[model samples]
Target: MGRNTRKRRTPPAAKAIAAAAALALGGGGLLWANFHASAHEPDQRAWGGNQTKAATAQVATVSCPDVGQRLTNVPDAARQGVARELAALDRQITEAYARLAATRDAQAKDPGFVRNAIVGPLGEKRAATIDRIRIVVQRAGGSFDNALEQLAPCATRSANQTNAGGGQQNGDGQQNGGQQNGGQQDNGGRQGGGIGGQAGNGPVAADFVDITKVAPNVQGKPRRTANASTGTFTTRCGVNANKNHNTDNVIVAPGVTNGAHHLHDYVGNQKVDAFANNQTLLQGGTSCRNGGDLSSYYWPVVRVQDGTRDFDQNADGGGKEGNVGRILTPVQAEIKYVGSPAAKVVAMPRFLRIITGDAKTTTNGLANANAHWSCTGFENKVQLTERYPICPQGSKVVRSFAFQSCWDGRNTDSANHRTHVAFADPASGVCPNGFKAIPQLTMRLVYAVPPPVIRNGQVMNAYAVDGFPEQLHKPATDHDDFISVTRNGLANQIANCLNRGQNCA
Candidate 1:
C-alpha cells in the first residue's frame, strides 16, 4: 500500500503532444497561467483597429505560458517550493489582468498601451518567478534552463483571438456550432462588455445551445473481453447540501491559499483545503453513508447568473474572482466504481489523488478536456463539452465525470499529478502497457436548473461552472477531483464487489 514503491512512466504520447500552451489567469481561481503555450493563438499583442474595436479588437484576457505543466520532473525536495512559486506566477497574471481591465480606456486610446502597460510588466514579474523555480529545480538535481524564460512573456488575447471556440458571430449575435473545435457562446457583446456577472468574461449568447438543435452525440461502448471485471460498487455521498465550499485546491497548489480562484463544492471527506495532507485527511470525517469510505470528492460550483450573491460574493473565489451568481446544489451526486471492461480492477492505494477534466480548458485547448454536459431526458443524445445545453422546460442539466480508471500500480501521485492514473483506451477498454486497471470513479451530478432564456439573441439567467477568471466560465472547464482514503480494507471490498459482479452500496 506504500505509494513510493510504484514505478512511474509518462506515456510517450503524453509528452509528444503536450508542449507549453497559453492560459488565461484571472480572478478568484488560482488559475495558474503558470505559462502554457497555445497552438491556436500565440502570445497576442493587441494590434490593428476596427470599427467595432470595443467589441472586436479589445483585449479580452491575459495569456501566459503554462510553466507548471512543464515541470513534470521537479524533485520532491524542490516540489513544495516550486509549487508555491508556480502559484505565485498565477497570482501575478491575475494582477496583470486586473490592470488590463482597469486600463481599458488607455488600451483603446493607444494600440501599444496594453503591450507597454500590462503585458510588458507581467512578463518581467513572471521571469523573476520562473528564475526562482529554476533555482530550486536545479538545486535538487533536476534539469532546468533559462530558456524557460521564453515562456515569461504574457500576451493579450483580443476578442477575436478568444472567440475561436465556435464559429463567428452572425447578424443575430449568435454563433454556429463547429465540429472541428467544440462550439462556444460569444454573445457578440455590446460595446463596453467588460463588466457582467463579473469582468464580462463570458457565457455569451453563443455559449448556450438548445439541446434540440444538437444531433445525437453518443458513441458506441468500448468492446469488453470475456475475462473483464464485470461488476460495480456504489458509494452514496450526499449532494453537498451541507454547503462545504472553498476556493482552495489542496492537490494542485497544496499550502497555497486561494489557489483555485474559483469556489468548489465538496462532499465525502470534510477536511480538504489548500493545506490538506494524507495524515489530516485520513483522520477527517466523511459525509458518505459508508463509514469506511472516506474519499474526498469535489467539483467547481455551478452558479446561476441571476444577479444573486452568496457568502463568498465579496471574497476571493467568489464574486471577487468573477464566479458570481447563486450556487446550485445538485439534487443528486452519484458516485460509483465500476470494473474495467478489459480486466479485474485492483485496489486503489490510500490517499491516491485524481483530477478529471481541465479547469483551464477554455484557454488550454481540448487536449485534457473531459467535460460531459447534457440534459436529463436528452442523456442519450450528444453530450457537449464547450457549450452549455439549454434543456427544455421539463428537463434538467447534468454534469458528469468519468475519472481515469487505470493506475500505474506504483506511485499514488506524480509531479504533474496526472500520469499516475489514466483512462483506458477509448475503443478497447485496455490499460496502457505497464498499467493496471482500477475501478473507474464515474460520477453524475444532476441539477434542477431553470433554462436560461435566449431572448433577442442574448442569453439571460445564465449558468456556468466556476473556473479561472480568464476561462470565462466555459463549460469545457468543468472538472472533478478525488482523493481515495479507503480504510479497513474498504478498497479490497470494492474490488471484490466489482469483480464478482455485485452492486454493493
Candidate 2:
C-alpha cells in the first residue's frame, strides 16, 4: 500500500475540464480568501465590530499540522506511539474548549463570570494542552510553531457583552444588532433571509444553478463503467447513536463552539471531535452495522418542533430563528461504498474530511440547494421549506447526502478540505483525469416527523433542527461531514475487489 506502488494515469480532458471549472467558478481566489479570513470572523461579528482593527499584534496563520507527514520517516512502533499521544492530546484540547463554551453559554449575561469563571480557567488549560501538542510535534521532528499555526485561536478578547445584559429581544432586534455591529445582513435581516437562507411561507423556485447541468460535456466514452461484472461494496453504518453538539471536530473552523448552531448525529467512530487526528479515529470503536469499518459520518440533528417549542429558545443573541424544541433522532442511517470499474480505487488518506451544504446560509433562497427534503416514497419530490415536511400518514421523512470521491493523490485535506477533491461527472460517473477515484460514499437518513397540525391559518409542523432558530429549518441548512478511518486492510480490499469487479458486502 505504499504510495510509489500505485499507478498514475492522466486524463488530460478531465483535468482540463476541472481546471476550467475551478477558474470559471473563481474557486482558487475563494479558497485563498477563506484561508486568509479569520476563523473567528463570524463570532467577532456576532459580538459586534472588529476589536483588532487598531491593534498592532500580527494574527497567526492557524492550520492543522499534517500528522501524516510526521509519521513518514519514523519507525513503525514510534509512529504508533506518536499517533496515540497526539490523539490523546486532541481529545484533551477539545474537552477543554467544550467546558469553556458551556460555561460561557450558561453565564453569557455576566461579563465578569465569563472572564473570570469561564475564559481564564479554560484558556490556561487550553494553552497547557497546546504546549503539550508542540512537544509531541517536536518529538516527531516537526516544527512546534508550524503545528500551533494550524490550530484555531483559543482566545477571543473582543466578543460583544451587551446581549448577555439580561435583555431578551425579538428576531428583528437581533438582526438589527448584527447590522449595527458591522455584520453583513441579507434581506434586511428578515428571519432566514440571508445567504444559506430557507424559504418562507411556501416553496420558491430553485435559486442556484445545478453545477452538473452546466459543466462542459467532455466528449468521449469513459474507459470503465459499472456493469454486471463490475461489483460494488456497501457498508451499512447504523443509526446515529451519538449526538456531537460541540464544535470541536471542525478543525478548520477552530475556536468556533456551537458554530454549527445546531446539533449533529454521529455514527461509525465513537470518539471524534474537532481535535481528532487519524490515530485517534483508527483506535476508536464504531457504531456501524458492519462494526469493522470505522469511518466517521455526521449531519445536522433534524427535529419536528411543534408551534409551542423552538430550538433557539435557549440561544443567546438576536438573529434567532423559530422554535426548534427538543431535538429528535433519526430512525436509521445508511452508508454505502462503490467504485468505478475502469480504475483501481485508491485508499483515502487519513482525516480526509468532506462537507456539503452552507452553514452560513440565511433566507437568500438558494443557499441550501444541495439540501434535499422529501417524504419516504416520493423521494423525487424535493422541497425547499423552512418548516419540516408533513409526510402522508404512511410516509417517512428522509435526508440524503452524496460525497465527493475523487482525490488529488497528495493531500488528505486542504485549507477548505474541498478543493483537493472533486465530484465525478454526473453524466459519465467518471472522475476527471489526475484524480484517483475512491469508494463513492452516500448517506440516507430517515427522521421521525409526525403529521402537521393545523393551527389558525398556518400549517405548523412539530420539531425541527436548530439553525438560526428565527428561520424555519429549511433544507439550506442540511449539511454533512465525513472522515475516512477505514483500516488499511479494508481499504485495500475495496481497491482489489472494485478493480476486479467483485461485489462485496
Candidate 3:
C-alpha cells in the first residue's frame, strides 16, 4: 500500500518524498512568514534590523523526558522510543525558532553581517537535532504505529510572543539590563536586544501550528431514495390530516412503525475518528478526546426559519400545494451535540431507528389526509468532531452518521461500510467545482492529538491531525466525486516555495 501507485507522469511515493524534503529544507517558505520575512529576500536576518518587542510570557516547558514517561506505559518499546524521538524533534523545532530569533537580533546592530555565519550554524544544529530524533525512532522496535498520535500534540512556543514575566526587549533593540553598543551590546551580553555579543542573524523558524479545531464543515446530505415510490410507504399519520395532502403520502405502506422507510444519503467519514476507551474519564484513561464519543451525547437537528406563514389548507397539493406555507428548501442540518435531553433519548440505538420519520405531521381536516412525513431528507448529518469516544460497556455511541439515502437504492441496507460511488448526481455531473474526486479510495485513519500540546500559547485546545491513506476502491463508480482535502492549504503554500526555492530567504 505504501508503494508508488500514482499516475504515469508522477509516482505517489515520489511526490510524498518531495513534500517531506520541501518542509525539511525550508524550501516551503512557510518558516519565513513567522519571522515576518519575504520569500523573495536573500537572507532573513537582513530584515531583523528592526527588532520587535520580545514576548514576555514564559512557557511551561514540556521536555522530551516527560513525553518519554508517557511512552513507558505503552507495551511497545519501539513505539515508546518513537514517541521520545518525536518529543526530541519537537524540542529541536523549538530551539530552531530560538536560534533564528537570536541570529536575527545580532545582525540588526552590526552593518557587517555575514549570511553564512548565521544560516550555516542553525542548519547544522537543526540537522544534529533531527539525527538524534531519528536514531530514537529507529530504535523503536515495532513498525511506526501511532507515532504521529503521540507527536502531534507536543506544542512548541513562538519566540515572537511575550515571555511570561521576563525582562523586556523592544522594537528599538534596547536591552533593559545592559550598556548599549550603538544599540549593539547591552551589559547582559545577551547578543541581540541590547544584550552583549551578536549571535548570527537569521529569520525565526516557524513553530508547529495546531489545526484540530476549525469551523464545522458540511458533512454530507441525507434524503429519501430516488426509486422509493411516493405512495408506497405510509406516514405515521394518515393522509387526511396532512397539510400537503398529495405530498404527505411520500411515506406510504407497511406503516411508520416497521415500515420500509429508510434514511437516505447522510454519511460522516469514520476513518478520521480517533480511538478511545469509554471505561474512564481520567486523563489517559481513554484515547478519545474533543468530540470523540466516550460519553453519551445527542446532536439535535433543528429548523431555522427565516419567515413565518400559515399552511396552504386550501391548495390541492401540487405545484401550488408544494409551494404552500414556505416549507424549508433543506439547505443544511443544524445539530446540537451537548445538553439536550430530548436529543439524547432520540439518538439511542433502537429509538434512533424508531423515529426515522419524525417530521412534523400536517392535518387537512380528513382522516386519510393525515400522515407524518419522513424526516430522512430533512435532517443534517452529524459527526463526532473529536477522537472516537471510548464507550462504556453496552453504551450506544455513534461513530458515523450513515444516512439511509446512501444505501436507499443499493442492496446495502445494513452498514456494509464499503466505499461506494460518492457524489454522482447527474444534475451536477462528476467532480464538483474546486475538487478532483480520486476514484481510488485512499483511506487514511487519522488519530486525534489534542492541544495546547500541538501549538504553544493557544487559548483554545487544538488537536493533531495525522493519518495514513489506505487502499484503493476498485472498479470506480460513475458518480465518484473528486476527492478533496480541506487541510492542504499549507501543502499548497509549500509547493509554491519549492517551485521558487532558489530566490527564497
Q: On residues 1-505, what C-alpha lDDT tens digit does candidate 2 reach at each position?
A: 1111114222333322333322211110000001122234333222111111111111110011222222233332233344444344334333333343224333434534533543334334333444554555557665444333222122222323111111221211232111132211121121221211111111111222222223232245345554411556777766755554443335333333443434566778877765566777888888766666888887766644332333344443111222234466778777766675455577666667777654323322232235655667656544432224556677777777767778888767654345667787766666788898877777778877776443322233433444433222434546678887776477777666766777787
lDDT string, candidate 1, 1-505, tens digits: 0111113222322211221232221111212111212234222222101111123233344456667766667788888888899889878866665565455456666766665666666666676788788888888888885556556665554443445335322212233344332322322333333222323555565667899999898998787888788888999989998899889988889899999888999999998998889899988899999999899999999988765666776678776656777789999999999998888889888989999998765545556779999999888867998788999888889998999999999988777788889889999999999999998999999998989887664567778888877676778789999999989899999998888888788
Off by over 4 Å in 3: 1-21, 24-29, 32-75, 102-105, 109-118, 142-505
Q: Give me the runs in candidate 1 sitting further than 4 Å from their true place.
A: 1-57, 164-198
Leading candidate by lDDT: 1
* Backbone-clash count (model 1): 27
Model 3 scores worst on lDDT over the 10 consecutive residues at 468-477
lDDT of 3 by residue, 219-302 (tens): 433232432111111001111111211121111111122111111111121121112111121122111122222121111111
Per-model CA lDDT versus the true structure: 0.70, 0.44, 0.21
TM-score of each: 0.85, 0.53, 0.24
Better of 1 and 3 by lDDT: 1
